[model samples]
Target: MSAMQLDAPQVYDVIVVGGGNAALCAALSAHKAGATVVILEAASREERGGNSRFAGTAFRAPHQGLAHVKTVLCEQALEDAERCSMSPYTPEDYRNDLQSTSHGRNDPLMSEIMIQDAWETIEWMKDKGVRWETTLRKYYNIETQKGIIIDLMSGAPVKVVGDGEGLIRDLYNAVENASIPVRYDCPAHELLTSGDTVYGVRTRQTDKYVDFYGQVLLACGGFSANPAMRRQYLGEGWDLVPVRGTRHNTGTMLRRAVEAGARPVGHWGAAHASPQDIDAPLTGDITKTPVIPRYSYTYGISVNVEGKRFFDEGEAEFGLTYAKIGKMIGDQPRAIAYQIFDQKTIYLLQTRYSSGRPIVADTIRELATKLDVNPTVLERTVQEFNAACPGADIGHFDPHHLDGLCTSSSLAIPKSNWALRLERGPFVAYGVTCGITFTYGGIASDDKARVLNNEGKAMPGLYCAGEIAGGVFYHNYAGGAGLTKGAVFGRIAGREAALRAKGAGGEAARFRPCKMEAAISSRRTA
Candidate 1:
């Protein structure tokens, strides 16, 4: 919906730019804290949720047990969540996850903030009219292929009460109920700055540019959808990779912030990507984004267009290493891979989220033909994999924990785990390619989500959160953490910006500045 033309005030308390999980979270949080908040979204109302609408309803929030889930989720999901098995995700676990996932390159302060405040953010969302559900996982043991027990995800799996849409819906409801004006189809082209302070924004409206004055909170997301930025930062073949989220995330907000002197942080060349259907739409399909990725590749094996296996599919690090798998596929021949699963592992497929139509055949050779892979090479690959499978040291083929059932290392690319032979008939293959989720590089912000100037000091009246604010993620990422990061930091930025706009920090603390490289160097050393 378009922003209502209430009496034109000189400025709002908080002007949250962008519309998504993070932006909505910020707007609602600011409104709750007794501030006039306005949300500026680039897309039309129909496409306003941004990438979040295309994602699975999963969240990586901290929780104690099933009881905590029951309290947070809606009544409809309570029963399923209560019946589901879950483990408590301690703050330390979240910290370790960030460290291990980013190989310790993530900002320690920001990582700690996410781990420390994730639970609070989820609870805050619940208070803001949001609901949650258990992000239940299902991995079957090779012995129980008929589907007896499927392990929940290896670690804690927290699903939003509803997937992405539900999240945005609830948040939108809150915004609407609060009468927070959200100007759809209006994109903020640049920040309205006064010395070191950001007082408002220069927005491009229907047919003209309008100046929106306010203490700005940026939740505009990263530059993944920007073709030129992708080619420039991520290098060749990057622009060809389909975007798994919104086309509106053209890095406009990010580039604007950088031009305004915000220091960029995190991996410029890296992003959170995944293996999506080869024929899926250029951007994420609103109907099936969360389920589009060929994540179940760990249960099978993937072959490139040449009918030759690529990387070890089993390296699908249940928690952290999932991001690498996408780029791996992007780097392959024609940026395509075929995930093959035989009858033995057919029951293990989570095909409910499958993005594109599936190609099925009774035999491996037939499946190869349909997938356009060399049938002879496919046959040899399966045969060789089968020979080494029976001798694998895969104790019990347990799906709960890490089952070390590995293929022969002598092969060019071995399936590190879940090495089941494609001996059964009725095989299936899903052609897949990489789709970029969010970019890794973004404006540097503090734990409180205050935007940092190039000189390392906080930029007055400017705050950032969501994918637009970077630091924690690098090349790798955990599955549901994106939403959590957005919510947690969004809430923080909203609250902090609201307080600052309310004159809580005073003039002396408001206008601090430092030298450029020195500020970055000091932040680095800290």
Candidate 2:
């Protein structure tokens, strides 16, 4: 197909589409670099803060002191990436786990770039008022010799405070304070090109079409939340089964890029293993709170459609589990799973961990009946878990020994190693279902964050970062890597775009009418 052309006017140094982390980062970075910037966001008022906000809010990096553990995690991620590569995920393998998670479809050069500059980015975040719980050098250990990592928590030396909302708010505040213009409810429809170079974007506001010409950066997020787009990109049977993430991510900008001749880097999908009720719409009055505590402590067997356990119950990484559950959605009885725990579990979780909710039942049978699972199967699952207690050391169950589970820690007890036995009669069961968090596949770009056309040429004046750019990981995501990647790449794209815009003298070049018509005609014929 041929590229779609657009007529644009009113140029700025940089025009960033989308209001999420990547977009915001790009705009702020460009503005800080002394470029006039504008941000076009679809949402009038930020609701859930997009996927970045809803995330676990951790960033993963190699331990500074323990090179051995850091090296191990990196090697493992690379090995996994090599094993999972398809045609699109070329030269599959990564020196970083974060890159492996992107299926090796990410630009290796960019991945290296981000890894080298990660510490600096974290420091930049600190300077911007986001607090971290730890020092710049300290690492949060995961026990299994995974080594140390950085985190954003209060009271740490570099204390980077806030969740996704805090990060976004701070970024938005910085950009606004710098006098960057943000036009809400404005969505870019197409790229305006001049000769072989991209000049700017044609945008659609609520009431009419407006041309917002500049070096355009597409950060409008992924197609995971869009049911129709999911069906088109993933498969006929695939639907965006709702769970977490903002509703504004509909892949509109992705569609625009594809129409402009950009090639998507990856083909695989990624999702969050969410609670069952995640599909239900939030009541208007229901306030958003941290949901980690409930997820961290809840113990239950996850069964597939065949009524069998699929993986170790205590495993922290939920992507593979979610994918397995997602594959069973169209099967008989519409595959569902349940979480079985007791009152003690709920109470301990609520008292010790934050955000744990109650799901009480008078008895195991009542809980089974409430969850619509086979009573015998539920009983057997519990019995099996109990039989494997004190380490739950089933052959396949590889549990990460954290501080809470080790005998050395004050929080640890004799029964700490045991997966909650679920022996008490008065039980609580909550259902859980899987859903998409963000799209892994996106327009292929270079280390500078310039979007590449199908022919492997960078589209001048057009760039992208965050979920909109792909070819980073092969499979499996390390906690906090997504947010880190978004910020890192957004910064790159913004700086490069600003430089390009400044060079272009603020007036976007115009495409020759004859060539533009020919390109459009060829598309119609194709």
lDDT by residue for model 2 (1-526), tens: 6433434346577889888778888888898777889888776664624566655455543333222212222232333222221111111221434444555455668677766766567667656555443222122222322322322121111223455566677777777677888887676677767544776676765454566756888888887667877777656445735535677787877877877788877654544333433233321112342342123332444444333455444432332223334333323245345455664344322221323343567865566666666767766655655555644323432232322331122211222332545666577544444445566678889878999999999988789988888776443454455677788988999999988876776244444234444544554442
Report the alpha-carbon TM-score of model 1 versus the true structure.
0.89
Tell me each candidate's TM-score: 0.89, 0.74
Local error of candidate 1 at residue 186 (angstroms): 0.9
lDDT of 2: 0.57
Model 1 scores worst on lDDT over the 10 consecutive residues at 508-517
Give a tens-digit lDDT track for model 1, residues 181-298: 9999988888766557776777876554565666889999998888899999998999888888988999988988888889998898999988787776777667666667667787
For the record, the alpha-carbon RMSD of candidate 1 to the native fold, in angstroms, is 6.7
| RMSD in Å for all candidates | 6.7, 9.7
After superposition, candidate 2 runs with Cα above 4 Å error: 1-8, 46-49, 62-96, 99-107, 134-160, 236-240, 276-279, 282-286, 289-294, 303-307, 315-335, 342-357, 361-363, 388-420, 506-526
**Number of clashing residue pairs in every model?**
5, 27
The global Cα lDDT (0 to 1) of model 1 is 0.77
